[model samples]
Target: MNKAIKVLAGLLVAQLLVILALQTNKPGTTQVAAQPLISVNLNTVDTLRIDDSDGGQVTLRKEGDRWQITNYGNQPADQNKVAELLQKLSDIEVRWPVASSAAAAERFEVAEGSAQKTLTFQTGDRVIDSLFMGTSPSYRRIHVRANGSDDIYQVELAQHDIPANPESWMDKTVLEFEGDILSVNAGDIAVSRDTNGDETSWKLAGSATDSTDPTLINTWVKRFNSLVVSALVPAQEVEPIIVQNPALTAHLSSDKGDADYAFYTANEKYYVKRFGSSALYEIASYQAKPIVEIEAKKFMLNTSDAEPPQ
Candidate 1:
């Protein structure tokens, strides 16, 4: 019995040792403390270019203090989007390298000339950092390999996050108004605002005071403040469309200045051009409907449409 007890105790010790070893990371384990994939000084980066497998590319450059999409006619870039991308790239950390061999890079589709996407940061002509992104392992994790490095890592960046399309980087809300719009005129339809004591009122042309729906006019003014276009029309298509008669023209008087917007419809797409802007934008039909269909009579309420007194 004493011998049997001793043997049982030895077996228990062996089992405990195995459990401890299994729970602890072994020597030569691939797991490592998280470290930044690329060290980039964002302030020195003035240009960013992205190339895709389909041979499409986009370049964004910093001009003065603002960012512009250089390939897309120097259109102002959405600053927030640009900043977010730079921040994400700077913050990506590598915990474990999936592979470090040249063959593995090609197999993962992160090698040069075979990568699904490549992004480069530059200061003038000098390249700051370049990275290749390829097949995603999961929804938000993609295989990435830095330029001149065979080590490939899986990072939390999807292909759609870094679009190679110039339009995706454009400032879609560039035409939105910044200040209070005091008045608006579109052909025979006119709307203006007035303030008396603590009361504010709106006037619609051809409609008596207090006869028009103030809510409708207020909504229209709000739309002007929050207008966002779908995308800018190509430069080559601008002259042809502008030469044709516009379907509607509206004048907006604001604290900033008076500006005119001409709306056109061609190829079943709605387009709007701010009189002073060189870029023409394509607008959705739903967004253009309120502005283009505005009429003085629409704002005026008929006697039967009035609500009974409380």
Candidate 2:
């Protein structure tokens, strides 16, 4: 009887040890993935629309493989800027949740109707996601709520707001005149230069030019070629503001018969309307005066006798 009891006790002890070993071998636990605030494949994106609180809106469309600023006269969008914007949106991960109450929305600038800015992401006219940008919690982070969710999340992005102005996305290279100019008509005055790419020699139509410094003509052409503008507004937006009687009109004809450039003066300000664009441009009076005041004699050196810049 004693031997049988000992055998049964040993069997029970062995069973318990096996169970403990089995539990120790299966000790791995499940882990949950960190959810991203905004997760959309970039290649699938179609359009990005931005609406501002000040009643301004901009639409950018992804066509083929490139993006275009659709609303601003279908202007070519700045690809580098557009890519940066897309990467920021894609990398947004929820750092933490903020206030979700209705009153908290307005105070935080994430309210459904009163948000400072709203970004609408679409895939072929179908709204995929809408993000309402709110007040910044810090310079490096912002409060944003996506898809009408009551919960406002703090994202890692530092952007205060999405770009709403079409010009903001437009490539600043509006016009790059690279052709060899053959002739120029500055208002009532007309001027012609050597067509063989030598701007040093210039002649006025029906008038004998005084002994003028050849370099002066060359320098003016260089200035005109390198002329940069502070800002350009689409003609459709502020057409009424454009002056009908321009202070100066300069028509440039390149070998390729390229576009013309016109200048206007109004309200003590100078504006330029480049060829091809319906937009009217505003240039500083100080900058525009030098180019607009160009004449046959202006090319003459100020010395007692006109001589080339030595």
Candidate 3:
């Protein structure tokens, strides 16, 4: 009886050990996860190419302080524009797979051979910038690899209302003036002054045949608006000898030519002069003061108050 009991105890001990060993050796219940697909660092990429689905490609290369389109004969690339593209790439956070429905698959082209694009980036060393595969009706999957890390992204061609043409953003009109005050000859004008009390108003002596012409005024206004104001002068210097009165005398001139004019707001009074030997040699000068300055004492106020506000 004693021997049978000892044998039973030995059997129980062996079974417990076996159970513990089997539990320890069995495969883990949780599965190991797959790695990500794309990664990149922008600062290191000196050269890169972005291929479009329409078979167009843009190649970017870093020049001295700027990036250039090397494939387009080394044209200058707007750095801010390229930075926006890089930001978009960096911000890609998701790459969901297309569904398996026939319409979905057809749209995504999953049955078709993978339309993959390989991007090569050259720093000091060459690296695969991105690998895009699989197409969808709305988007495509891009698998990117950079610095040995994986990033997956979904991309789609953005619909554009306007056609993509470089000329659309370029200057189209021939007479398009960009800067302030453009100067042109006004031909000729006769001048005189009307003096009433202490105040005087300068007037053109003849009826301007083209004076009320909208096109002429528009042309002159546009040109004058484009002129850059550099220095201001007193009215007496710019007026014709006959128009220059005892009360005022001064003028303004650009380093370039007399064809130009200056600008001032409507509330400001202006003294203008046309001077030259012939109508063709004419130039204009502009002098401005507050309209209230027509009052003698107010107009005589000097340079002391001209300083910029503190």
Q: If scored against the real structure, what TM-score would every candidate get?
A: 0.88, 0.67, 0.36
Better of 1 and 3 by TM-score: 1
**lDDT value for candidate 3?**
0.38
Give a tens-digit lDDT track for model 3, residues 1-310. 9999999999999999999888877888443443333355777778766553455466677887677766543545556666765665555554443243445433443222232333456774565455433333353433222222223334532222111222111111211233332222222422222323111232332443323232322332343333222222333433442333322222222223333222222212333222331111112233123211222121122334322111
Ranking by lDDT: 1, 2, 3
lDDT for each residue of candidate 2 in 183-254, tens digit (9 for 90 to 100):
777776566787777766776665555656556666665545666554666556456555376677677777
Better of 2 and 3 by lDDT: 2
lDDT of 1 by residue, 101-201 (tens): 98999999999999999999899989988999999999999999999888899999989989999889999898887677788888777888863311147
Candidate 2: worst-modelled 10 consecutive residues by lDDT = 301-310
Which whole-number lDDT from 0 to 100 does residue 114 have in model 2? Answer: 89
Q: Which is the better candidate, 1 or 2, if ranked by TM-score?
A: 1
CA deviation > 4 Å runs, candidate 2: 1-36, 62-79, 94-107, 148-151, 156-161, 180-183, 188-219, 223-243, 255-257, 275-278, 302-310
Highest TM-score against the true fold, candidate: 1
Error of 3 at 269 (Å): 46
